[model samples]
Structure formats: C-alpha cells, structure tokens
Target: MMRIVTAGYSRHTRSYYSNQAHGLKYFLVRLQTEGFCQALVNGTLYTIRPGDLLLCKPGDSYELMVQLGSNEPPSGDYFLSVELNEWMLEWWEDYKQEVKLNVGVDEMLISIWRHLVYEKRRVKDSNPDIMDYLCRSILLHMNRLISGGVSSNPYERSVSNQIKMFIEKNATEPITLRDVSTAVGLSVSRASQLFKEAFNQSVMDYAIEVRLSIAKERILIGGSTLQEVSFLCGFANYTHFNRSFRLRYGMSPSEYRRQVRPQ
Candidate 1:
C-alpha cells in the first residue's frame, strides 16, 4: 500500500521559489505539464520543461524555481508527495531513479495522475484502495516511458518516441496511420517517415508486429480460440492474422502454440 500525502496542480504566473535545502520528508514526483521552470537536481540547476518528470526520494535536497520573463508563459506542473510502503519501496529500488527524466507528457499518464489528484481531493470520502492503485498505475506507466531510448536529436527523438508510445498503447485497438499522425500532431507521411527513420520500420509494420506479439501471447495463454485471439488482438480476420503470424514466426499460430505448450 502507498499513501499520498498531498497531490495537486500548480501554476506560476510571475516568479516563485521553493527551497528545501534540509532535504524532503517524503517521496516527491513532479510532472511539468506546461511552460517551464528551473530546479536543483543532483547538485545542478536544470531547466525543467513540459514533459519533464522529476523524481526525488526522501531526504534528498530539492529546490524549485520559476522565473518568468516578460511575455513568457507561466510554469505549470502536477506534484505528488508520497509515503511509500514495503511494496512501493521494492518497486522504487528496482529502478535507478534519476533526479530528472524526460518522459514526454503522455496523456494516459496524465489522466491517471489527474484521477489520483481528484480522488485525493475527496478528503474524508477518498477511497484508499483507489488512490493506491492509481498511484501505482502512474508510476508503472512512467517507468515504461522512461525506458524508451533517446536519440541524439532531441526534437526528432521526442516526436519519434511519442509516435512509438502511441502505437504501443493503442496497438490492441483499431489504429491507422492517420491516427498515429494525429496523436503526435504530425502529418501521416511525416509520421511514417519519422518512425521508419528512428526505428528502421514503417509505422504500419511496427503496428502489425505489436498486434502479432499480442496475438502470440493470447494463443499461448489459452482460453481464447485462434479466431478469438485474432479479433481480440485487432486483426481483421483469422486469415490475415494467420498469414502475419506465420510470416513472423515461421509457423502457424496453432502450430506455434502447440510446440511451445506442454504435450
């Protein structure tokens, strides 16, 4: 179980500074969702921007400064102060938490945080279990976003990664090239070109690969028939799914499942 001490949104129009030189008392997770600011992270002051995530453990020196120049947008962020239990501690130790990570402002991740914030605001009526699960979901999703590889060109890398993440999250649903493009605010041709340049595979191909991977897992897990697996994994029909699976694995879905499963 995890306990959230405080969770809310903050926006600074002028200038603001939060200094905790003596260190913090609880785990702090902050996501910069709009504009930009500066923060002392790992003994160095860093310019934090939208899509930047800040993770701080207890007793870590944390400082945030928001300096707004004339005609500049205000700094905005979502923050949560958490008290970790045993399970949360285990999850924390499993990953090397950096002072700051550029995990891109993923909508799904923000949605989870928003829900957690709303539940926390419920005060006396807040359900502990719901808050706990929502917090865990945010952390887990952040982990995945942070694990993605970054390229040399920051702008290109961010756009390419946004496309990849969108495909991954929606692969099980009916997605198209236009859908991918719209999600990342890029034209269809541009999105396709960028994805191929970054990943060496076309967007549609990667989507098919993701779909087949899901289909394979469903086949191995049983309970779902081949046709059902195909449909559930976003395949238009069993024939198309069979063809794609065989092309990727060199065996029919049923054959692969049989060989991998017990006799």
Candidate 2:
C-alpha cells in the first residue's frame, strides 16, 4: 500500500496554477469537479473539464490554467499526494505517459475523494490503514483507466511523448534543439518536423514555453527574486526573460507575480 501524504480540495476563482518539477518528490492525483481548465504536460496541451483527472509522476513539470475571463466563475477540485512504490514506478514506465487521463464522470470516485479528505483532516484521529487502502484504491483505479485506454501503437507514440517529456524535465537546463534531436535518435530535420507535426509548435518554442511556465510557478510558490527566477528557469538574463515573458503572457513577470500574490 502507498502512503497518503496529503489530500485537500481546491476552489479557485479566476485563478491559475503554474508548477515546476524542480524539487517535487511525491506523485500527484487531481480530480476536476467543475469549470474548465487546460493543462500543459510535457509540451502537449490538454483541455480539462468536469470529471477529468490527471496523474503526474515525480519530476514532471505541469501548468494548469482555469480559462476564466473577467466575468467567469470559480472552479473546484480535489487533489491528493502519495508515496510511490516500485510497482507503480514500474507501471508508469510501461504505460503511455499521458498525464491528463480521463476516467469519465463517476460520482463514486468523488465520494472516495471526499472520504480521503475527511480522513486527512482528522490527522492521527483517523486510521492509517484505512487511509492507505483508500489511497491505493484511487491509484489502482486511475492506473487501470489509463492502461485500459491504450492506443494501438503506444510504442511508437511513446517516442514522441518521450521527446516531450524530456524537454519538460530538462527545460530548466541550457539544452538546445540539437540535443533534443539527438536524444530522440532522429535527424535534425526529422526531429523538428515530427515534433511540429505532433505539437504544432517548433521544439525550441515549446522549450521556451516550458521554461516560462515553470518560471511563473516558481515566482508564485518560491517568491524568488526576478533575476533569480529568470536564471533558474534557464533564461540568459533578466532582460531576455522580461522580453519573452511580456511577449508570451502580455505582462511582465513582476506584474503577474503581484497579481497572483495575496492581497
């Protein structure tokens, strides 16, 4: 059985989540109950809605946004953290690494989440064995859903997915398009062309997107200085970071930080 780290519900209004894998240690499972959200996993984007759930292995950077305009309403969801074991780790390697997997709409799963959260809130007052069993149940069910929905040629698709995952995992490093090309065992043109066909974006552009997403998340969570955030996110300097940030997001990093910070 897996260890239940933490479980809670998140309610957001006109909000967004930008997260990096820099020092993450636990595997994560999140369930969406309401509103619309989009998640970028390994350079590929997924549009998430009610009844959607996602699983992220350790060291995978992901960005989630609730496409809420000024008049849009709030969204709610539940998320849980758990310790990974050898069995699950082995399972991940075999399955297609699709982070945003769907389990359809199931109220039974929601009930399990509620029960887990209630137990988490109870602390030592709760039974560890029961919590562990519930947590294992969720993981097993999600893994089953993902495994059961496999594509016909996962071995081939996994190559493209591996390329995207490599970029996301190493986005903070000073890696080049050539490095990505070589890592994928494709020629420069082939790698670039294949990536474009799959993601509809150039490899370099996706790398920049990954870096910027991680930078935003770091600023919000770590509260690191602008220069530090830029450097940590693989920008050559703050000026380039500022320019890219403004171009990609229409707001400077500092301004966005202030917007998301508590008032």
Candidate 3:
C-alpha cells in the first residue's frame, strides 16, 4: 500500500536560503500555492509559480527558492514525503530525472490537503486512513497532470471488461446469461464463473446494480415521477422497483429523492 510519511504547509519571506542540502531519504513533493517559488530540480533551475509542483525521487538533490507576491505577506507551499508501494515505485521509475506538474491550483486538491494537515495534528481522530487516501489522490492527480490523462490499474483492466460493457449498454433492456455469454465468446457456465471471479457477483446481480444506479440518477434529477422511474430503469413493475430499491438503499424511491435533495 502507498504511504505518506509526513506532510505540512508553510510560508516564507524574501531572502531565505539553505546552503546545505539534506541527503535524500524519502520521495518529496513541494507544491507552490501563491506568489513565486523556485527550485533546482536535477541540476536545472525552475521558477515555479502558483499550481506548479516539484517531484523528486529518493536520491535526487533538491533546493527551494521563493519570492513573495505583491500584496501577499509570504510565499506559500505544501510539502509531502511519501513511500510508494511496489507498483507505484515501478510507475515512478518510468519518469525522467525530474518532472514538473502543472495542476493549476484546484480547489478540491486544496481542500483535501487542508484536511490531511488537520487530521495529522488530531492524533485522537481515529481516521488515519484519510491521509493515505488523500495522499494517493494528490499523487494520482499529479500523475494525471504530468501524463495528461488518467490511467487505470492493469490488474483491474484485465477483469470481465466485456461483460461489464454489455451490462452498462443494455441495463435498460432485458439482459440474459445466454446473451452475455455469446457476446463474450464464452459458454454460459464459463462466463458466469469468470464474472463471479472478477467482480465477486453474478452477472444478473451486477445488472441490477447498474439499473438501480440509473434509477438513482433519474430520481435525483427530479424530472420523473415514481411510475416513470420504475419503467425507465427497466423494472417490470412499480412494486418490484420499490422493493428492490428499499433492499439496496434502505429507502423508498421518493424518500431517497427527498433525502438527497439540496437544502
């Protein structure tokens, strides 16, 4: 699993410098949020402004330089020291000596980072896992920024893709084991076994989940009545839709809509 050894946010004024560089012991990320910042990444000087990030491996030398913006008291930056899992390390190895990511100052990433710093100080919060999730999110977002797209895990990509596509495309209509099996070029028994192994649920059960998901979107949109929702989501009868919805979400369709409505 991925790990964030430590993280913090800080600010600096003009004329601050560190002549001696610490020996690299952890993967480091320093992101500038305001004003101007600079760093020598892999022996090249870079002037990083708001939303620019610096990434370094375990053995690379790094240094920070910051200049305050006009009307701003100090330059702002956030730092993270991380321990990547084996797969993540392998992913990192594919990059060059130094990489710069331009994420462009996202609010969600800022919110997540603030919460992570708050949780780090509250030792009794009993929610340490939030930091791990947030750190992973930041790293993934940086990867997206650098790579120019999102990437999926290879193991997850290899599992029951054809069956899932068929279910999503046909969830509004009647679907069957024979149809799915034929589409995937597998016998019905073999298809059933493979789907179960990959998704831990039978094909029909996943189909219901997909259908219910569609119904939920429609319900939340509030452009349809309960009767329309039942038929539109592929339920044979309104009573069956009500029962299945209650079983999965513990509320009637109408009740769910009300609960999720904006206050």
The best candidate in terms of lDDT: 1
Give the alpha carbon lDDT tens digit for every residue of 1-263 in model 3.
55777788988866455432554667877788877767875677888777777777777777776655556567788888877567558767766555676655555567678777787677676365777787778767556445432223222222355576678889988778998989878899988877777667899989889999999999888878889999998888999899989999999998998898855
Alpha-carbon lDDT, every model: 0.85, 0.75, 0.73
Report the lDDT tens digits of candidate 2 across residue range 93-159.
7544567655554444667778888988895588888888787677676554444323333333334
The clash count for each model shown is 0, 0, 0
**Candidate 3 Cα misplacement greater than 4 A, ranges:** 19-22, 67-73, 146-263
Candidate 1 lDDT over 1-263, as tens digits, reads 88999988999999999999688988888999999999895587888989888878888888899989899998889998988578667767855456777877777788999999999999589999999999999889887766554455545667888898888899989898999999989899988887788788899899999999988788778998888999999888889999999999899998998887867
**Cα deviation of 185, candidate 2, in Å:** 51
How does model 3 fare in lDDT? Answer: 0.73
**Local lDDT at 120 for model 1:** 94
**Sorted on TM-score, highest at the top, how do the candidates line up?**
1, 3, 2
Of the pair 1 and 2, which is ahead by TM-score?
1
Query: Which candidate, 1 or 2, has the higher lDDT?
Result: 1
Which residue pairs overlap in candidate 3's backbone? none
